[model samples]
Target: MSVTISFNNVIKKYNDKPVISGLSLDIKKGEFFTLLGPSGCGKTTLLRMVAGFNSIEGGEITFDDKVMNRITPQHRNIGMVFQNYAIFPNLSVKNNVAFGLKNRKIPKDEIERRVDHILDVVQISQFKNSMPENLSGGQQQRIALARAIVMEPNVLLMDEPLSNLDAKLRVDMREAIKLIQHEVGITTVYVTHDQEEAMAVSDRIAVMNSGVIQQVGTPREIYQRPANIFVSNFIGRTNIVERSLKKVDNRQVLIMDENYQIDLDDITQYAEEIIKVSIRPEEFTISDTSEGMAGVIQHNVFLGINVHYTVQLSNGENVEVTEESTLGEPLEPGTEVKLLVNKEKINLFHYESEKNILEGDSYAK
Candidate 1:
């Protein structure tokens, strides 16, 4: 079963300090949407509100065009998988998965049939009789998922469900979750602080910060074109170049720093007072030629598949770059080198407002 979930102008607070403020979003039926942010950013609070764990202050929540504000959590038909994988330690896997159905007073034969079917879907049918303590962390997690899904809830909410497992296991488990979610086609809202995980699994991501959603977009869109300085800096590694803009010629502005000057042409409507420019690490290329910008190599780090080089620009700015190869003689510390900045790859932001004008007007607010 699937239904569209909507949070319209949602607000939540404790002691008058707003945890979630006028947050609005919509999760499509059978869509995998993620609420991603750091701790205290209100992602969990928003999720709890949807789960009916927390009360909404000044907004409305609806499911399938029905007002859910007064609905109890149980009656909401919402399934949730928490970080701890809450399962009865003493109960066997099969029993644990069947517990929810039993509580709902389902028929005995139908309960068994449904439990067996879900166990097979989770690939834990053989371990159904095994206690949770006897299973690996990943197995236990799967059991938790099986329990939630067996209820056939209209909406599934997962709160950092893979956080307890090891890194390798986390990756594997998410793949399983994605596959199972696809087969079940349940509308899902996943909450997490891990950007990579959100990007990997979500159909859309709402990046939250300071009790507000900074941006919402697909993984590629959010990564390639951030909404603001905070979004760019948080989503990936970027070198923020602080500079002032001066009109150099007709329809062109010169980006002037302490030791470098680059021409910026085809300025946008909001590019009147450029304060900062963000460039991704991969956008820089090191060479022997004295073109573009000049910098001194500070350090080189080799990570097998990629090489990270820290370069100190002539303007006393240090920037890190990731290269494809560390081969062919590395640049030692304090070595002078030239950097080629991909001008087209630069992201310009307003200084006073601290907003990326490239993202459009709605993003500025």
Candidate 2:
């Protein structure tokens, strides 16, 4: 049975410092959701609250409309997988997976059936008799997952469960976890600092910073249309250039930079001051002739599939452009090049503030 989870004005504190403040979220049943942010951003704390490991100081948490504020961890009907795997070293894989059922005093035959089933589901049946120390990192993690999910909890909470694995193993484990969640249709809440992992696996992502949710959306929504400057900067790389806006007509404004003048329409309702124009690295083309801005290549990094060029504009500002490797010969440092910024792909944000010059229209269309 899957369950919907909700948080209403949730707050947490440690040493009088607010770790999570006024957080409210609704997680749908059987959805794979990820809490993504930098370290010390309160994602782990929020997960712990849901697991009944930490106390909520304000608001309430509900699972399937039942207030879970006072529920004990054992009674919450939730499974958890941690970063360290946490398997008993002395026990064989089969025994570790059956430990929870053993504690519950389940019938020996039923425990054996469930353990065998989960081991097969996690594709570790062949290693059932092996000790945890004998398994690879990925194998150990699968065992941990099997142990948790065999309990058939309504919700699953994972905290940096892949952090200890190698890069290649982390990728494989994420795919495996997603596949398993889909097969079981469990409501899952995952916490991680890796933006790529969150983007790759989650049905939706909640971006948090300093105890607040900056934005929550589908991976494409968050990447293509950020809610604010912080969201824009944090989710991916962008070239932010300062610009001043001059009224051109009733519905148009001319943006002035050091060497370029571009027209923009439909100003945001909250946009009164023009600050910076944000262009993604892939939104520009490199050419020999100047469209408006002229710059000299400062650095060129060849990253196998795509080449990155850092150019210093005439105004002494740095702009980065990513181009396909097959376009031309590699650009060398000190080479002069003109960059054409895509007008349709440009995003303007208020200077150092949450107010967007394009309002929410950036994400709407």
Candidate 3:
């Protein structure tokens, strides 16, 4: 069965410097939660803390309400998959998966039964007798996964398990891992620097930066409604506008570089004087009959499903616009076009604090 994991005001430090400070999060039972961020963002640090590989300088980590701050790594009952396939090369697939159970002094029959079942679950049953050297990278990864899941720990932790695989194998193995995790129904905390990988496999993501939790939400929420400038730019391609907000006849208008103004009817009236707005590439479309801001297509690239265009506005700022390839012939460089945006989809952040103004607006009392 799966267990709920909680980190309560957790802190970690190296020498006198803090690496993870006052981090707290709850992961639901059987949920595939991911810690996503770039290197030095403390995502791996958080994962290691959960695994009992790092000491907690303050607060506590618990599994199903049981404190684990003082527990040793082996006693915590957590299964871990590493970036390097940690299976033994000389051992056959069956022996590698059985290693954990054997150490526990499980009965021979029980070990065979569990190992056989987990191998099948990971779809490596046919290679049970094959040595690690004989297996492909993806197969070896599957063996490592089988080894971890065979122990049936309370929680499963994976640290960039697919990073060593080739591009196509990463894609294939992520799908495989997701399926196996669902079958086993274990609480999982995955760590990865790849935003796309996190989005593809996680039920929810905790975006971290500089030892702090930035935003925690479902993949769609984090991507579509990022909490700040860091998340907006990190999760995907975004065009951020540093603009001023002013009330113009009962409506808020976004002023771009003291020149162009776009009416922000959906924006709250309590918006700050200056704010940052995030617009995704796919949010812009070619307007019909000059309905919106005019821009010159600086360049265009034809992707399979969409044509990406770099549009230079009159203010000398460039915006990326992605239109469906079905929209018609791709616009050539220097082509004049009118770009329209979804007003409601535009996200606004506080200029100073860089927090999501919309989220604050919802919780404002």
Candidate whose lDDT is highest: 3
> Which ranges of candidate 2 are over 4 A from the true structure?
254-259, 265-272, 359-365
Question: Evaluated with TM-score, which candidate comes out highest?
Answer: 3
List of clashing residue pairs for candidate 3: none
> What's the TM for model 1?
0.92
Q: For candidate 3, which ten residues in a row score worst on lDDT? A: 356-365
Question: TM per model?
Answer: 0.92, 0.93, 0.94
lDDT string for model 3 (228-268, tens) is 88999999898988778888788878775443467765566
Quote the positional error of residue 303 for candidate 1 in Å. Answer: 1.5
Tens-place lDDT digits, model 2, residues 1-365: 79999999998989878888889999999999999999999999999999999998999999989999999989999999999989999999999999999999999999999999999899999999999998899999999999999999999999999999999999999999999989888999999999889998899999999989999999988887777777788888998777776654444554545566766655635333557777889988886565657888999998888999998988898988999998877899999888877766677777777445664444444
Off by over 4 Å in 1: 251-266, 270-272, 326-329, 359-365
lDDT by residue (tens digit), candidate 1, 1-365 = 99999989988989988888888888899999999988889898888989999988889999989988879998999999999998999899999999999998999999999999999999999997898989999999999999999999999999999988999999999889988998999999999898889888988999999989999998877877788888888887899887667754455464544455666544646434647888899888886675657888899987777788999887788999877874566668988888877666677778877777653322223
lDDT of 2: 0.87
Candidate with more favorable, higher TM-score: 1 or 3: 3
**Rank by lDDT (best first):** 3, 2, 1
Q: Report, for all candidates in order, the number of backbone clashes.
A: 0, 0, 0
Ranking by TM-score: 3, 2, 1
TM-score result, candidate 3? 0.94
Runs in model 3 with CA error above 4 Å?
A: 255-265, 359-365
